[model samples]
Target chain A: MNNLAVDLPGLQLKNPIMPASGCFGFGREYSEFYDLSKLGAIMMKAATGSERFGNATPRVAETASGMLNAIGLQNPGVESIIETEVSYLANYELPIIANIAGSSIEEYEKVAAAFNETDHVHALELNISCPNVKEGGIQFGTDPKMAANVTERVKKASNLPVYVKLSPNVSDIVAMATAVEAAGADGLSMINTLTGMQIHLPSKRPLLANQTGGLSGAAIKPVAIRMIYEVKQQVSIPIIGMGGITTSEDVLEFLLAGASAVAVGTANFQNPFICPELIDALPHTLKKYGFNTVQDAIGKGITV
Target chain B: MKKETMRIKSTKRIALDTVEMVLENNYMSQTAVPGQFLHLLVSGHTLRRPISIADVNKTEHTITILFKMLGSGTHDLASYQVGMTIDALGPSGNGFQLHNDNQSTILLIGGGIGVPPLYYLGKTLAQLDMHIISVLGFQTSKSVFYEEKFRALGETYIVTDDGSYGDQGFVTDVLHSVESFDRYYSCGPVPMLQAVTASLKDKPGYISLEERMGCGVGACFACVIPTDDAGGYKKICKDGPVFDAQEVSL
Candidate 1:
């Protein structure tokens, strides 16, 4: 039996491994690497109300065991994504989750409502946590009231289940998680990239064109696990955990820390085959840890 | 487009802070084109370093990469011994388009590390019997490599910032002396590319660009450059590491 299959709200994943949003880019680039069907689910890039050109050049900086990116939610807006990108993804058999972001509550609602017309989109990953964008993004994620307001409005506007991606730059992660859950969030994608910066010695200035970028990679794994562990005990909704997930062992660690499913982010850049490789390795790794199924391992490490 | 573990066949310092590495991989050697690059994984670094393909020998099943030891990632790549294998994904990005008119003259402009890809392009064009003229620039004489090889192909000019070798000044100084060419191709730093594009604005040409990238594939959107078209931008990793000289904003 394939013990890798996982079920989250509005998503029946073949496995617990999927490429995180922003990292996968609408599944077009990675489709050249391997079969998209091999993935558990596809988290499409963040779509706003209109086109976004994002940050200037030198948007990425490499750090130890990780990388920082200030991509600023660059996308072709919701309508174009639905007509071009989403329609292209509809050819695949797996579920597709649209990651929606915007500068204001009205824009978030408009983007969320727009996804309801798409035939293949199964859920919406509310991206109030993108640290790179200056106008919106992390501002909502860091505040509980703003986070819930966006969540409630998006939930009201869209027919699909909403998964609020939480930012780690907050003073209270549990409060942020519970607030969204109370506001009708069906699930949670916890621990978005931590805010970070790198210095270029020769230039004697910040490395990224944007002063700071969101940090993602193996360096943030422990932080993801800690947040998931804390939020799992407080909320009834499922958690889709991600942060520096690279290996099957890392997947199991996220599952053990209370993530119902895992998303591979920065590691996908390191190896394009990471998501499918993790899917193939998950069953064996699960057996090695004595778990018969993915559901059995969720929150196993969290004590009541 | 494919990921494979390519074995290091040889490694040697070709210039100041520059090392030439020849990696053995039948797939890459065959598929790699003139301006495409190899995204190499150096041990202990999360992101891979993208180095341009300097040469390819399909019969030997090897592709040569020339890069400067700029940071820890590239510094680690320079340390690998012969026979050791390193993971690489590539022959990535759009390569330079070759014009096959035998009677036409083509000019090649390259600066610093950017000079590597032009070597492969020059070699390809030389075989087609097209007239090739190369103007290569460096910081000093010590940083220059492939002067003799380029000279073997066609009329080659060398320039340095400090008058250490050949002409003293940028490649633009020599561009005027070359007289005329049907087309031009360039790969270098952005400022150098901008200057080259400006000087050769009347002639049709292609320019390969470089930027800090996350996913060497198009997914990350980390290496995008603005275009004059309605799409507003193009990903340097996917749409091109190479673009029409007149298309991009610079």
Candidate 2:
């Protein structure tokens, strides 16, 4: 058997197949289907400083190849996560990535600092790329300076590794990657959902109550590959590539395009067996490509 | 959640836009209950579509699902052949709470696609010796379905918007006439659920809600419904697709 272990900046995993935040809750929902300990890591849903109920009803809209969601980062606050969620997750022998986002830098630092106190948490995924909320989410993500500022604050506050999850809505994603890297982000999680909107013809209004949302699914794979390739050239930090990755081949595509790890985001909604299936398929895929280890596939597409 | 390759036993067009499909799955038939749903993976769709289990024949190991061709996913599901196999993940969600009280009368209300699960609920309750009163509403006469099936279990009331068949108005019209309903179970559009909640304020009611879900598990917060408490959200997929009527804000 080949070594599928992925060593990110401050975290190591048995494999590189983990569910993206917002798709996998605190890990209980998917645990019913299969044991979650088989994957690389579990990124808990994005939590805020305080509990958020999120937007009103009609928060999701199905698109041609993907779905649009304006979940508004509804969660049970950081305290609840540490006390209730993160503790329960401790039963499983798996790495946990606490995906944190807030409306302000202080809010971001507050959540990060809280997670930093917990030994159960392996890393903190700074979610500056969420496009659903009215404040602090995508605003910091779209601007390089603001993105760097949030990353800097989080890195200083948290003892755990900080991976800044970048948004795909910006015109120059490479610029965003570079900014966060320069600001001392430990690692990077690329390609958060793109901004999108859908409408119901009968009512002639938006399908989601939030009016616009973040689009994620197989439709965004090509774009994710492009951006990961672009950012891989600009930054030396290990990039965790996501957005529309469904298959082992898709994971290989991201790795070859320069992702150190690949996350199964929207695909988990389609198939609960995805992460395990991909993990099981990776060995055969590596052999098919004449590669011995997962590390060999990284940046295989980039040439001097 | 159990994943099974269930064979389609039969498919019949029961109404204008709705199709009733009975799938043969031994384990699911033995386990499924009312208010629970099945997440079906259509061959080409990226997300699984959550469909309610309309009926279950435990003896035959068959589960019936009623769905309308509202989108490409259901459209693809509508095209399945009898011998064809499809992947199903289910008997999921907290289904209707079936209490042990036997002497009290039970009321069930459903609208459109929401009517399916009520059939299963009524059937389950009937077996327990509970008197089931069902009020099923549709947009018009042509869309009405399962009247005979629901009638077999108990006293069934049918209402339509255009008065083409049964009562001349909404389910609320018939609901006003019926008294002494001890327990209430409802599943339908949000408006229908809201109206039902308003009428049954004095009774213990459980409402099954519908939302566009990403993962039909508690994982994705896509199918959240705001509750009466501030910043408190209940997941329709996990905490409920079935919620206490008084607890939900709608």
lDDT tens digits by residue: candidate 2, B1-250: 6888889999989998899999999989999988899889898887788999989999999999999998878999999989999898888899999999986799999998899999888988988889989999998999999999889988899999899989888888899887678899999988898888897788899999888887887788888777866666688888888888987788
Instruction: For candidate 2, write residues A1-304 as lDDT tens digits.
Output: 5479888877788899899998888888788878988879999999899988888768888888898998889898999999999999999888999999999999999999999999899999999988988988989999999999999999999889999999999898989999999999888998899899998997999989999998999999999999999989989999999989888899999999999998898888878888999999999998898888999999998875
Which residue segments of model 2 deviate by more than 4 Å?
Answer: none
Could you tell me how far off, in angstroms, the CA of residue B152 lies in candidate 2 after the best superposition? 1.9
What would the C-alpha RMSD of candidate 2 be, to one decimal place? Answer: 1.5
**A1-304: candidate 1 lDDT, tens digit per residue:** 6677778889998888888999989999889988898888999999999999898879999998899999988899999999999999988888999999999999999999999987799999999999998899989998999999999999999889999999999989999999999999999998799999999999999999998998999999999999999999999999999999988999999999999998888998889999888888888898999999999999999887
Give one digit per residue, the lDDT tens place, for model 1 in B1-250.
7999999999999999999999999899999999999998899999988888999999999999999999999889989999999999998999999977886899999999999999999999999998899999999999999999999989999999999999999998999999689999999988999999998899999999999988999998999998865658989988889999998898
lDDT, residue B197, model 2: 88
DockQ, model 1, C-alpha based: 0.86
- Per-residue lDDT, model 1, residue A174, is 97
Q: Name the lDDT value of residue A281 in candidate 2.
A: 97
